[model samples]
Target: MAPKVLFVLTSHNKLGNLDKPTGWYLPELAHPYHVLHGKTDITVASPKGGEAPLDPASVDAAKDAVSVAFLANHEAVWKTTRKLADFKGKAADFDALFYVGGHGPMFDLVDSATSQQLIREFWEAGKVVSAVCHAPAVFYDARLSDGSLLVEGKEVTAFTNAEEEQAGLTDVVPFLPEDALNKASGGKFVKGEELWAEKVVVSGRLITGQNPASATAVGEAIAKALGV
Candidate 1:
């Protein structure tokens, strides 16, 4: 049987307190989804059971070919996701847990008790736990069975502060992913020399991607970890 991966998307739609909208970033989800599309079985899920919002900016016409293809082929999955709360105590059913990022996860998943619980369960089961871009925000407060931060002392990478600044959302988002990850990892979080460069960090069963540019690589790493 193909390895089953649970892809977690953000249900939060509003960006900060602004009138603008945001949710899971398309490239972060699309790139990774495309990478594992035929190689594994994937389940789309979110904090809410129904539709999860998509970051409008990521849907621009200038998006890469893979992103376009993903929307055309797999957007239905994105439109309807399983409620994350239902997956509690079900870690063994999955080979990995992946968090897809946008500004949304910084708000919802970061504070979600259910999300934290799932992460701990997956880690304790020795299954792959991964995220890309701002999705790493979920790890900001995630602790393992021993009561230690999941990212603590683990080499990890996520959307950088510099990249957040570059995107002009430095102060808009609730918290910066880089800073949160740095604190969670005890300064073990690393990034590329330059912003937006593809970087995927794998430490044991934990894998993280620096930004949307590294999303596909994160998925590839998960596949390798699953021996698929």
Candidate 2:
């Protein structure tokens, strides 16, 4: 049997109060799903067992090839929109766990006891624990058995401060991931290119992507690291 990968997605939207448009920035979910969905047996789950809310902007008209392909993915369409409880995990059943991101995660995921426990439990088993974009925010409160911060001194990346600022939603976000990661990690943070840049960082079994654009690359790293 193919190695099982547990993919935890967010069911909430951070932009709930905003009258503005938003959706699951499809690339953040679709790109990685496209790359890993077929080769790996993937399980999709969310904080609640319900259809995940999409960032409207992700599905709006886009003239790019990536966006077009992302919108057309059947596997992503069929399996990705699931509730967290529907795919509740047992770490040993999966070889790796990937958390897809969006501004939504900054709110729902961080506040989820289920996701936090899942993160800690998966890492305790030495399984690959990965997240991209805002999803990494979920790790701010996680820790190791030694009491050290979970990501301390590890190479990592996330949605850039500039991107958050550029989006004009930083002030409204639950917490700034770039800042929370830097402060909580107690490790100096670095960038790959620039805001909205395609950046990915890997240290052992932990993997992160800079922004939604880096999803597929980060997925590739997770695949390679887990030897899938």
Candidate 3:
């Protein structure tokens, strides 16, 4: 049987108090969905559930074919996402857990006790754990069995501080994902030479991608780790 993957998306949609709209990056979810859809069974979940919001900036159909295709089938996929709080599935039921990111996860998943538990459960169960871009924020409070952070001593990557500066939302976001990961994990945070360059780091079963451009690569890494 193919491995089942749980995809966690952010339900929060606002960029701090700026009133600017923000949610999961479309390509972050779309590209991975396309890459892993055939290899594994996927179920989308979110803090608030329902239809998870999408970052307006990531909706350019002209440039993102996978995202465009995902939107075209939004009714079948996006509309059916389950609420994380309500998901009855156990960690052992799935082979891996993936977190899709945008500025939204920094606000919600970062401090979500439920999310932390899920991550811990999945990791302790020996399931693959992965995140990309701002999704790495989910690891801010996720602790391992040893009480250390799951990212601690593990090679990882996420939305870099420089990338946040480039996006000019360094101040707008509640906290920098890279900074949180660094402080929480006390591990080396890696980045690519240029902003948005595809970079995926795999340390054991933990996988991370630097930015939106690294989404597909992250998916591929996760697939390989799962031996799919």
Top candidate (TM-score): 1
| Model 1 per-residue lDDT tens digits across residues 1-228 | 999999999999998988999988998998888888789999989998789999888898327999988888886888889999999999999999999988888888898999999999999998999999998888888998888989888898889989999899998988888888898889998999988989999999999999988988998999899998
Worst 10 residues of 2 by lDDT: 73-82
lDDT of 3 by residue, 2-51 (tens): 89999998988899989789888888988888889989999889988788
Q: Per-residue alpha-carbon lDDT of model 2 for 62-158, expressed as tens digits? A: 4366667766655455245566554445787888888888777777787677777777778988889998888888888777657777888876788
lDDT scores for all predictions? 0.90, 0.76, 0.86
Report the number of clashing residue pairs per model.
0, 11, 0
Better of 1 and 3 by TM-score: 1
Note the residue pairs that clash in candidate 3: none
Q: Which is the better candidate, 1 or 2, if ranked by TM-score?
A: 1
Instruction: Estimate candidate 1's alpha-carbon lDDT, on a 0 to 1 scale.
Output: 0.90
Runs in model 2 lying further than 4 Å from the true structure? 14-16, 21-23, 61-63, 75-89
Rank candidates by lDDT, best first: 1, 3, 2
Task: Identify the candidate with maximal lDDT.
Answer: 1
